[model samples]
Target chain A: MSDIKARVSFLGKSANILIWLLLIGACAFVVTPLLFMFSASFMPAIDIMKLPYPWVSDHIHRQNYWNGLRGPDGSFVFLRNTLNSLIVALAVTITTVLLSSLSGYGLAKFRFKGRNAVFMLIMATMMIPFETIMIPLYMVSMKMGLQDSYAGLIVPFLTNAFGVFLMRQFLLTFPDEVLDAARIDGASEPRIFTHIVLPNSGPAIATLAILTFRSQWDNLLWPLLVVQSDEMKTIPLYITKFMAETHSDEGIMMAVAAMASLPMFILFFTMSKYFISTEGLHSTIKG
Target chain B: MQYNKRFSMEQKKAVWGWIFVAPSLLFFLVFSFYPIFNAIYMSFFKKNLLSLKPPEFVGWGNYVYLFHSKTFWQSVSNTAVFTIGTFIPLVVFSLMLAVFIVSRPRFQKFFQMALYSPAALSSVVAALIWLLIFDPRGLANQTLNTLMRTSGVNYHWLSSSSMLRLSTIIVYFWKYVGYFTVVFVAGIGGIPDYLHEAALIDGADSWKDFWHITFPLLKPTTLLVSVMVMIQCLKTFSTQYLFSTSGAPTRPIDVITLSIYNTAIKDHNIGRASAMSVLLFLVMLILTWLQLRIAKTEDVTYN
Candidate 1:
């Protein structure tokens, strides 16, 4: 019996090691594309395709990075576009978080007529694919003279259903008595919302802001349809334009792509803890 | 008198609740709900952008044409393959990864961080990076060639039509497995440890415990993950656009979302595209409803 037990333990250890190896292998496979992209960005134009390994070259073509940052005429077009995306993302995040929190607070804390109906309506909107409405939205944007403008890009996404849903859910965790106490202290509803509620709901707001910012930054299709000029292009649109115009220049294209991803990569690596913890908290809060 | 006053207060509370939620409701109606209805309306009309003529009512003509079109049918099959191909592996891999991570708390944070990193990369960026890696002389092909040299195994991983579909599925899995793993981790973490402890005391092995306890408990999460995956697959476009070569191949990789993009943006056939959108929406709705039903039945059985 002891011999058999020992064999079983040995088998389990080997199996666990194998599983760990497989897991690490999968993680490496996932990161390989990103690594290759980074490597390719530093390769010379002539060496882009000459490869068993793209990064096996003797010298790194650092000029590709400079050219990527500068435009065809040596202007800082890429930096300008990145700035535009950041601005739009930041503006959208702020607007969305504020609106969502206010609305979420109302829904969670207040008892009102037609409240369930309104909430259900907002929930149903989540099912409607944005693609189905793109054309009409385009026409509307044109009619409203908002095309080619940041306001057009930011305004439409400001009142996000996901944000409202997330906020409402978070607000549920707040004690009702606390709000009642504030009310009895003659704290006005708006004041309670601005001071007590907003101050306490930092984590939810942070999650919403991060999600909204990332999405808007990466938004491709809508921006493609709306932004006509190269000046108005966001980073995704900028990379796409670079691809279309310079299909032959793999080094430059890869360089631009790397630049587009750098900010998001930094943000994600630094703020990953929030990403893991926020989802469950939001779900339970929403429930 | 006090009871009557409290009832009035309750009514007042209900009124204020609606007032707070009104802006969101209005925004949804005008922007979301209205556009969907508008798409349905647009589907019934025949109007070309260049002609600028008022829409001529076409009734079910658009739908009938869509059903009859060869490309539409091909796209439908492609969508099915894509959906099934990506979802099965994604679900299995995520669950396994979650279980592995959950078992080892020491490396849990690191694994979770690494897995969720891909999601932070924009889809466009991900597509661009994968495009480079999947190129003929790219890392994937180069690695395969090296293996072929050593092992005498030669295969076209992305050149053939079916192989291309498989490649796309692999890319999809790599991108999404982390997101779903996180979700599953949340679900698995929520399962009480006492249950696992009890099973251990009863002489149940790890595999047996997982089958008898963990898998059954993760049903709701499975349902949620499946639904999200299906919707995501339906919306998939940028990766396909960036990866596939232009023009038809022996095995087509055209999915429904790509078809809509082609018709609307490339072909400039807006009416037909809107019709396609309507059909896609209906299909998604039916599938979602079916999934909900399956989830409900599973819940009943488990209970």
Candidate 2:
């Protein structure tokens, strides 16, 4: 019996080590593409097919960044596109957070006619994929002359169903007693929301903001239709058009891809706690 | 008089509620609800995307045409193939990774961040990066060659039909597996620790514990992730779009969204595109409903 127990323990120990090795291997597989992208971005050009795989460039060539930013024709066109992406992403994030929080607060705290109906209406739309509505949305934008403008890019997606759902989920857990205390102190509804509720909603707002900003930053198809001019193009659109139109060097293309990803990487690294926390998962998962 | 004052105050709060919800409701009406209705309406009409003339009423013409169209059916099959191919591995691998990460003795965050790094990047960037790897002389073939001790063998990753499909699946898997894993980790975290403890006290082994407890409790999360993955895979556009436009054959990778884009913008046939959108929407709706129904039946059996 002791001999059998000893063998079982030994087997479990080996299994645990194997599992850890597998975990490390999976991480390596995940990081390899991005690592390759980063390494290739710094090279003038790489013989990517070289034996043993040139996982790192021989020398860090920084000019790829300059070349990438300058566009294929040396016109510095990508700067404008990057700025457009920043503007749209920032605008969408700010608006989505504000609108979602307010609406979420109302539904969570108040009992009103049509409150549940309104919440359900918004949530039901979550099932409708953006692709389903893309054609008619494009037509509506065209009819409204929203195409090829900042408004066209920003207006339709100012708020999202997920944001509302997330905010509501968070707010439902907020203490009603605090709101009642504020009300008893003669604080108005708007004042209470601005001072009391908003102050307490940091985690939810952060999760929602990061999610909204990331999505808008990476938005592609709608912008593909809405923006006709290169000047108005977002980063994803610019990258696609650049790749298609320029046939630029691989190094420069990787540099552009790296630049596009840098913000999200920074965002993830700096605020990663929010990302992996239950709050972040809460944003995506149903309650 | 006192009751009347209290009643007015309750009414006032309700008014504030409406005031707060009005903006979002109005935005949804214009951007979401109206567009859905419009897409359905437009599916029955023949219209040129660029033409100023009024649309011609075609009734069921667009739907019938799509039913008979080779390209439409091809897009549907491509979408089905991609969705099934991607979501199964996605659901399984992510769940496995989540279990691995959660069970680990250390560095859980490091594993998660490493896995989720790709999720942060745009699909365009993901596709572009993979395109480089899929290049004939790129890391993909080089890695394969070295691993197999073969010389100068090209996998034809982006050229061969089967290989091309596999390549897209690999990119998507890399991008989203970490994301779904993180979600699953969260789901596992939500399982009460005392249940695990009780199982241990009752002499349940780890594998049995997971099967009898964690897996059953994780059903909702698994359902959620599967549904999300299915919808996302069905709606996959950017990777396939970038890949095809970058010189890979369009026939193999021409997903529904890409087809919709081409039909509307390239072919200038908005009516046909709208009809396709409607069909895709129905497919998504029915699949979700079916999944939910299956889960419900299984729940009954479990009890």
Residue clash pairs of candidate 2: none
What's the C-alpha lDDT at position A141 in model 2? 90
Which residue runs of candidate 1 sit more than 4 Å off their true CA positions? A1-11, A54-56, A281-287, B1-15, B148-159, B244-251, B287-303
Cα lDDT tens digits, model 2, A1-96, are 012111112137677788778788888888999989988888867444455567666777889899999887888989899999999999999999
| Residue lDDT tens for model 2, B49-95 | 99998999999999999999999999889988999999999999899
In model 2 chain B, which range of ten residues has the least summed lDDT? B294-303
lDDT for each of the candidates?
Answer: 0.76, 0.85
lDDT tens digits, residue span B12-114, model 1: 5666666667776777888888778888898997756546677889998888998899989999899899999999899889888887777667677788888
lDDT, candidate 1, residue A199? 95
Give residue B150's lDDT in candidate 1 (0 to 100): 52
Q: How would you class the docking of model 2?
A: acceptable
Listed per model, the TM-scores of chain A against the true chain A are 0.90, 0.91
Worst 10 residues of 2 chain A by lDDT: A1-10
Of the candidates shown, which would achieve the greatest DockQ relative to the real structure?
A: 2
User: After aligning candidate 1 to the native by TM-score, how far in Å is the CA of A220 from where it should be?
Assistant: 1.2
